[model samples]
Target: MNRTFKVALAAGAATVALAACTNSSTDGTPTPATNGVASQTKSSSTTSGKPSNGDDLNISRFADKPCDLIKPDQLTALGNFRPGESSSAPLGPGCSWFGVDALKDTTFFVTLVTKGDNLESMAENAKSFPIFKRTTIAGREAYSADRTDGKASCSTAVSTSAKDAIFVQGRPPANGTGTADKSCQASEKVAAIVIGNLKG
Candidate 1:
């Protein structure tokens, strides 16, 4: 299997572990009303002052359509990139865009995982990187890390809810010329776009 695939599988496993350990329920089983009345059905709509736990809008909804998260105009603005393949794996669903330039080429991917609380998971994983930085994207907390592979790779984890997040990873194009920071910036930009779509 591909190294990327293996990494994704590992992520998926971690996600499952975290989710199983977290309390995702907002309320327990409904109770009967007085006077032998039935309890009112609770609305699924998000309530004000309540933090999202990803229960209202789960990542599984996009498990098979990750490519739809990005718009065509957004892709054009990013780099006139060609649409790459989409995949559904243990880590969730993801899509990649490929861009080629005279001097550098780039590949950017976006993935969503619903099984875990990425905010906490990123905290632990960031310790392994020398360039991990906390930031915000789309008004949500996020973490950016420079991959050990040097300037060729970058990744960002943006929290979608208390229990889920979307991960964006980018790599310099084959034989391409670009710095690690540039790759990371590109990944962040793509992540913001994807998050914007999700929020809307």
Candidate 2:
């Protein structure tokens, strides 16, 4: 397969893997099993009585400057970091920021997927998430997934519109001592910042 196809496939597979980790009951609602494991519910098309259309935001504005989605100050708040790197992908534009010093080896990835085909693929993959939950960030419908194996990684998907979404994935520094929850929390923090900026 070609490089572009491979990247698209890899992105799709990541989404599917996240969906597969969701621990839900047959009815699609989140439930804690008898074993005491709690599952996050799959969100519907609407959230907080609001539609997931993301009409108030424009994702295209950031398509060419995904790296600028988060400001330098925000990166400093997240942790010591190097400059961001940019790339293009089938999904849209992508950016990555790495941690510095003690966190020098860790990185956070953000991407915008605007094509209808890509979003549809992600929507299908979202179904397999064992811990997908609806959330509101900057008054937009958002979903998040946690690593099932207790790793320091988190993924968040924000619905920019019916056919577009922003994907944020974060991993703790390879040599850092942060916990999985901390890593996910960091991901959420970054997602919140990104959504806030997009709303501007």
Candidate 3:
């Protein structure tokens, strides 16, 4: 369910990075850890892993290189995506899209878009989804989204800690139609792998 995210072209794209204080960790929960680059605090004080070269986590990898962690068979690329300073990766399908925004050295923002019959209609259609259950990793917060209408559907997820955050999203299609579901699901899973494989 992969598609190019056209939302990047829209003006005033909302910045959804979890690092911002304004965006509460999906659950409104708090962690007692200092925010530092490459440093992270798990929910239980467990060592998730270390970044490579004993250096702080650098999000530049994803920005600089397009790693195809998502298998071609698992999902087809609707097209190529070029992330901007404000928007990390913007890719879309015929009528759906996904992207992210980096909040800091360790945090990246995210967004998901579905084709709307019109601008106002799209906003209204997006309201049907509910915030997912929050999962805290290394004392950070995370969550996903699932929404639908008679003609379109979309979902998204965000993982965050004191040090960094990852955002993933998808939009299959209306009535379980397009690749949005698979894209959203695979993107979130790949995001976890990226975070889990961090070297710091």
Which residue runs does candidate 3 get wrong by more than 4 Å?
1-57, 66-129, 136-141, 146-160, 175-187, 196-200
What is the Cα-based TM-score of model 3? 0.35
In what order do the candidates fall by lDDT, top score first? 1, 2, 3
Name model 2 segments beyond 4 Å from true: 1-54, 101-106, 117-123, 146-150, 177-180
Task: Encode model 2's per-residue lDDT on 43-93: one tens digit a residue.
Answer: 352222334543756879888888999998888777766688776754567
State the displacement of the C-alpha of residue 111, model 1, in Å, after optimal TM-score superposition.
0.6
lDDT of 3 by residue, 87-140 (tens): 432221111123322111111223221111111221222333442333443333
What is the Å distance of residue 59 in model 3 from its true position?
2.3
> Which predicted model would earn the best lDDT?
1
Q: How do all the candidates rank in terms of TM-score, highest first?
A: 1, 2, 3
In model 3, the worst 10-residue window by lDDT is: 32-41
Model 1, residue 134: C-alpha shift (Å)? 0.7
What does the lDDT come to for candidate 3? 0.30
- Backbone clash pairs for candidate 2 read 19-128, 19-129, 20-128, 21-130, 22-129, 22-130, 22-131, 23-130
Which of 1 and 3 is ahead in lDDT?
A: 1
